[model samples]
Target chain A: MADIKSPVPGTFYTQATPDAPVYKAQGDTVTVGDVIGLVEVMKTFIEIKSDMAGTFAGYAVENEAAVSAGQTLAQLDG
Target chain B: MAERSAIKRLFIANRGEIAVRIIRAAQGLGIHTIQAYSEADAEMLAVRMADEAICVGPAQAAKSYLNIEALVQAARDRDADAVHPGYGFLAENAGFVRAIEAAGMRFVGPSADTIDRMGDKVSAREAAQAAGVPVVPGSKGRIETLEMALAAADEIGYPVMIKASAGGGGKGIRVAKNADDLAQMAPQAQAEAKAAFGDGGLYLERAIQSPRHIEVQILGDGTDAVHCFERECSMQRRRQKVWEEAGAVCLDEGIRDKLCASAVALAKAANYVGAGTLEYLYDSAANEFFFIEMNTRIQVEHPVTEMITGLDLVQEMIRVSGGEKLRFTQDQIVRDGHAIEVRINAEDPILQFMPFPGQVGSMRLPEGDGIRFDHFLYEGYQIPPFYDSLLGKLVVHADTRAEAIVKLAKALDELSIDGLKTTAPLHRALAADISVLTDSFHTQWLEPWLEAGNLTATP
Candidate 1:
């Protein structure tokens, strides 16, 4: 299965907010439109979505970890 | 950013020739230098010359130079006392400047407030107007609707220029000679401006015909300022300046005095610091000058001014940021000799200036008493497509304009970078042209000249 990648260079976060539940955990199922993480750059936040409909392998980066463009934020397996 | 006066080690947040320029300037002042490099630039001259070099990120500018948080962290990790953004990337970014300051590191350029004011074209026009600097007639506020632009056109008159409020380097600019042209070009200009500069707000300005793009160089210490003559940057292609010369010709002495004085006045009004440039459109027919914008940091053509003034602007910027006042007063500064700068890019002028980025098989630069070549390319070096196509800059100074042109021709002949096409031939050809020599060239000169086989003239 393909992976969800960061569309831009920025800090990555698994959840939308501090109090919100994580979007995905290990072995969780995901769809094409599922928001796996958020990539923030220059104060603009963009949602990183999975392309493959499969089981989520959790985030490669932790909260506030810097990520580059095209960096794989999460892996998926059918 | 860190407080002033504590700077011992400066982390240069850029790459290529500008990065090397900053590092050398810092080393000359006995300040320890740190260079931030992308993976592609790990072996560049700037990285090798610095006291220490660290890989900030990969090749793409967004991953490297434009990564503000990464740059700040790199500075913090290295314990860098200050950060010097040498044009491009985050040089004029007010938010980046603020972030650098907030990280307890100094940004060795203009204050964040000044950057915020001048970074935007609309506000810069207001600042210039408030300082009594002549400004092109334009809308004082953002035009939210096409009707608003139409109203502004009626008041400012037709043949107006539609520009993005946050534009630079000729992007987001559309000249509508009539109402029909305005109706078609306005929205396209706005969309491009929004994509390029992140500001879609449109404004209108009276488009001055045959205007010479002249700019005054100024150095300020937040309290005092001085002018360093002017640069004629009319030789441009697609709004990107290709060739520049010091001390514009045909500019009356009275108009020169007024332009220089107005530039200083604008700087003082902003409490501007470090090296800055005030651009203007000199309408020779009307004998009037209109302020365009103020570049908040060192300019690409800064070497031409440096060649004529014998001033190390980069060093002066660092010193001034460290609390050093203006070293030379108005009278103390003297203009000497003539200088010209040509941007050598890896592109084909015969084709539509498309970037020819690739490996540099062999490279040899000119060396002489008054020839200065600023570049990062070398034998085996790869010119990446991820950044600007500026391969190098060739600058020469001589006793007079004619002599400087001759020296430039020689310097261009002596310089060679193999396996990659460069604009050297274009500079050589342009230098030999009598029109360019006689200072009759305009902003629209290059493309037509190239199209007409004029730039292919043998040197």
Candidate 2:
């Protein structure tokens, strides 16, 4: 299975907020439609969901890191 | 009392560097200023620099910059005596100007009627022709059918440019070199014209070969007007000016005088007041100048003219709207040195000038005796995607054109911006090229140079 990608160019957030519970962690088993992270651009937040079901190989980028279009985020083990 | 009273408080009805530029001018003149912005521009440099700032609406320009009611309401709330439309949003909107006047505040520009007349390209062309300005050979008015366009093209000859009569910015423009080409282009042009300008009216003109795009800067109060020389805007990508320079390098004295005189004549004919530009296509080899259009507001390239003429066009606009006569006569207007302006956009030039919006980390502008940078970018400022990618303008002036080009190259090398990519490298490379360095260029220079791997510096 292929990895899900970011929909827009922005900063990546792992969870809702720092004090809130983490949505997904490193090496966590996830499925299609599972919440991966959030991409925030210009104060607009959008959920990043996995398109394939598999254990995460950890995110390719760090939380709050600047990202560009077509940049890889996570790798799903087929 | 209203006629003689200077503008005490001015409201800038736009955003970005132009807003900042106006604010500085107003401050210098002891006028309190207010800047209105969209939600996306909360942290913009212009907002931070203004004495007062208010959020007009969301990121979308239609709800913010183009929102007439919101702009007028803000002007009223701030108790502004005059509203300067700057360049883009409502600068040429006749209705907005009328509303501002109706609200008992001065519109720092020509009367609403003049804007309306020049906003319509067909009427503007007729006005220019009547004022002894040479216009390109083309159709007289809007074309309703393919047959009509075909007939007009036949009379005007082939290799003609078809354009939307109601729009600018190179939208809905197509060139047909022959009969077969015209057959395939007419309907497509009409559809594009309709979609872009909400008007399907199309006009045709003879497309001169590699003509340089030149424009004369004119300032007026109602009774008299003066020309502030000309700017050569031939360097373009996607039909939009990327780089511009004052005093077209190729045009000789005679052609330059003719172009400037025609621009002044057209402005007088339209009763145009304030800072406006009359754009023309100058065929240097033939020494013929054809009037293309007149921008009914201040232009993005006005600074280059300012660099050469030592005039504050925006201040002139304000004083004129206050009913003051034009201070300078035509003969007294002088051009000193050569000046060039390059629009530095926050775009990845290698990616076809795609917008590269991100947090601007560390911004360092170029500095020199003759270099001037007009921008709104700041450290930690996130560039929004809802508007134009123009980050700033870098302008330079020197005693000679060759010296100006050299100075521009040096200034560009010193400039640096961290975070998202920009077109600085592309400009630097273009400046260093032998063709551009020696002033051997045309309107077709930049795009083809990039495509041919000329500007290969990585972003």
Which is the leading candidate under TM-score?
Answer: 2
Ten contiguous residues minimizing lDDT sum, candidate 2 chain A:
A38-47
Write out the backbone clash pairs for model 1. Answer: B1-B101, B1-B102, B1-B105, B2-B104, B2-B105, B2-B106
Which pairs of residues have clashing backbones in candidate 2? none
lDDT (Cα, tens digit) per residue for candidate 2, span B1-459: 554437888899998889989988888777788999998789888788888988888766778899999999999999998999998889999999988988999998999999988888878888998999998888987897889889999998778898988877676678998988888998899888888878888889887878888899999887688899999999988778988999887888877888888888888877777999988887666667888888989899899999999999888888898778888799888999999999888787776665677778887788979999998888888887666778899999999989998899898988899997888888888888888887777788777788998776533
lDDT of 1 by residue, B92-164 (tens): 9998989988998888989999999998987998888899998887786898677888888988877899988
Model 2: residues with Cα > 4 Å off, grouped in runs: A1-78, B1-5, B139-204, B457-459
Cα lDDT of model 1 by residue, A1-78, tens digit: 667787656568789987999999999989888888876543346688777799987677787776766788888888
Score residue B55 of candidate 2 by CA lDDT: 85
True contacts kept of each: 0.00, 0.00
Worst 10 residues of 2 chain B by lDDT: B1-10
Provide the TM-score for each candidate, comma-separated: 0.76, 0.78
